[model samples]
Target: MYDRLHHFYQHALALDNTPAPDKLTLHFPNDRPRKLVLDKSKLSQAEIALLNTLFHTNVAVHHQVTQENEWLYEWLINGHSPPKHKLERLTPPPLRCIHFSIKGELNEIDAFIEAIKNVFPSVTNLLWKSRTEGVLLQHLPEDTVEEELSVESIIDTLATDFLIQTSFFIGSPIDSSHLLYERFKWETTLYDAVKMTFRKKSFFYEQEIVTYYLLHHIPESTLKLVSTMLDSVMNDRELIHSIKTYLECNMNTSLAAKKMYVHRNTLQYRVDKFIEKTAIDIKQFANAAAVYLLILRLEAK
Candidate 1:
């Protein structure tokens, strides 16, 4: 339903954390983690009232997103390139975006900023996309010996201070300064979609971005069909767990057995049995990808 309604509107931001000022941010009581954004200019008060009555949701008419800094407002809200002057003026390259998503309200903006600086000493810049959305610009150090940043620590700090369970995604380093805005926006969209799946306060990186994209774009019908390819494995709880762990461990029998607390020979037997039952050459990347996605699809369901 969310996707159908989202497709109908040309400017829908299907669960975007940073709701553009040009779009109307609608919140449904049922869909708490998502905000269906649309161009409110295209909706009259009468139409808006009717929509409210029909969908049982509230529409927040954003009045020109001018609350943030001028450059940030333009870059994030208007989807404009970062000002050349600011790019030239600020610190050098190697800055990457850390897109954050928090569940509840943030009453202490000052404290939140302090916590960010504490967690990331090399943080060169920062900006809030919305109350629930923010971006931290970090200048990753050239040297590798510095203290490693623990995502759990940062998550705990924010949760204790702001009383909101937060999740963040560390984007790939911006190779080109010109692509900074575009790349950050893309990561923010991905973060918004993937954050809800993570139960604990933690972080993710660029490696999982493509997997999440497939999860978002693939239809349930196709996933259901894919599951049928390995229905026997899916039906048996042990084979399901064993195969998933084995594939996730890169099809290494001993490593998967160690991870799953099973003997190597036992895992190898299970693997052979699964291949004989399904006739799937799970060692191949393509076959592994389909099975991995099927497992993820069922887990998500």
Candidate 2:
């Protein structure tokens, strides 16, 4: 049964038998002790229900945590709101939503929640979006630098405590509670694309990744036009990388030079050469951004 199901709908089915919190699953009946899975995204609710009846079993929610928040469950599981009134009851903001993705099935959910709370003590809302993903809505503490360190600590602890890998996208603050759903949906969607495109990085910040995320969506013809801005320097790998490092270091010649292992003067000379060739002074942030995105487009190829 498993082999036949996998052969037909493997493109949409989960790789393993474990179901997502948002997916519908039919547990084994009295005749056998194995899970019967289906791709909920490809099947209507009524269609899945007929299969559930054929299997002589009832459908089950993949995880217990999702069941606790009826309103959250509706949004996450059903991919729709519970009702207008329920959504409007969200807690007041300056709340920031942090999205976490688990790499494998995690058994230490209790420990994981504790870890999140220990690092971010201001957590006001928590929900399991899927069996392997969670979200937290928290009132941010004032220490900006500390917030990043704490998120890193959570990753470290997850490796040690849960023995599973994970990543987080720390989202921008939602100034109003009413905009939570719209804002979260947008942020999470962008983070997912960025994470897929840049699989090497584990942590993503909204402010840091948004530029690349937007650039990734542009047409190739549009990218080519941006590419022309740095036409001469496109093949100069050293100069391009140095400028990228320099811009990323906030155009501080000394700092950029230190990171590039070159003298301050040498770094400035490369910067001068770049400006001379491209006629685009990267000293300004806007011009630098265009050049930066162009370099990224080249590297991606």
Candidate 3:
């Protein structure tokens, strides 16, 4: 497919009568030089469109006949010459490209390709590499679906979906040798790797996983402190409710007391005791709020 596309591009160039000019050069913002020649004029409008879509801007076509094929080599080694400016400044933001290889009947392949094109008009590169092989289509700025939901919820959905897809293929007592010990560990590792590769370039969305290793690895004493705090206030539903209400009210003792239909002094004493018992200072606001929320989340689960 790649070879056919290359051939087609060259043929298109030839057909355009723009037969690879001699010594054509392009100066980027960084004063970097990129030199290349169209071996032929076989490029299609779709291919050109794909390139434009990926770059987010039109690229000045250059044809160099005299110079050796040193443009790619120099650009890679010299780091986009001139060194002062950046290539990104001259070009558009990075884009993602999704490549598809279709085979089988020509009519069927053409229909499929057309369907994709209709949905993704920005996709420009479509090449019928061979009659029997099929077409190769490249779509820039990969598709992404966004929804209003929590990250954890998103991860859970993904995990569930994955299990459903693989469920039919596996028998009882599925193989686990290749799997990581903790599901969250696998999730985090996959998240980091995917983010590194496709997070910015592609529009496709994925969940960001948070590890609970910090909590799990904490000292036993610290764990005990958290447990003790939960147990002590576990039965004190009224106090817990009041404290939550007060915190949610921005730690305004007067407002919280009024909301709870209690005297300001009474609210103050409860708040003070909450701080003392949990070793979390409610006066500091931020830290107190974090602990308060953490407890609430844990309790809800």
- Flag regions of model 3 displaced more than 4 Å: 1-225
Model 1 regions lying over 4 Å from their true place? 1-70, 80-83, 145-163, 196-203, 235-238, 260-262
- Tell me each candidate's TM-score: 0.69, 0.66, 0.27
Best by TM-score: 1
**Worst lDDT 10-window in candidate 3:** 165-174
Pairs that collide, model 1: none
> Which 10-residue span in candidate 2 carries the lowest summed lDDT?
56-65
Candidate 1 lDDT (Cα, 0 to 1)? 0.70
Flag clash pairs in model 2. none
Task: Report the C-alpha lDDT of model 1 over 190-217, residue by residue, as the tens digit.
Answer: 7766666534426787888658756766
Q: Following a full C-alpha superposition, what root-mean-square deviation does model 3 have from the true structure?
A: 21.0
**Winner by lDDT between candidate 3 and candidate 1:** 1
Instruction: Give the Cα error of residue 43 in candidate 3, in Å.
Output: 32
Across residues 198-283, which tens digit of lDDT does each residue of candidate 2 receive? 56567888788788687667788887777777878878889888999998898999999998889999999999999999899999
Write the number of the candidate with greater TM-score, choosing between 2 and 3.
2
Per-residue error at 254 for model 3, in Å? 1.1
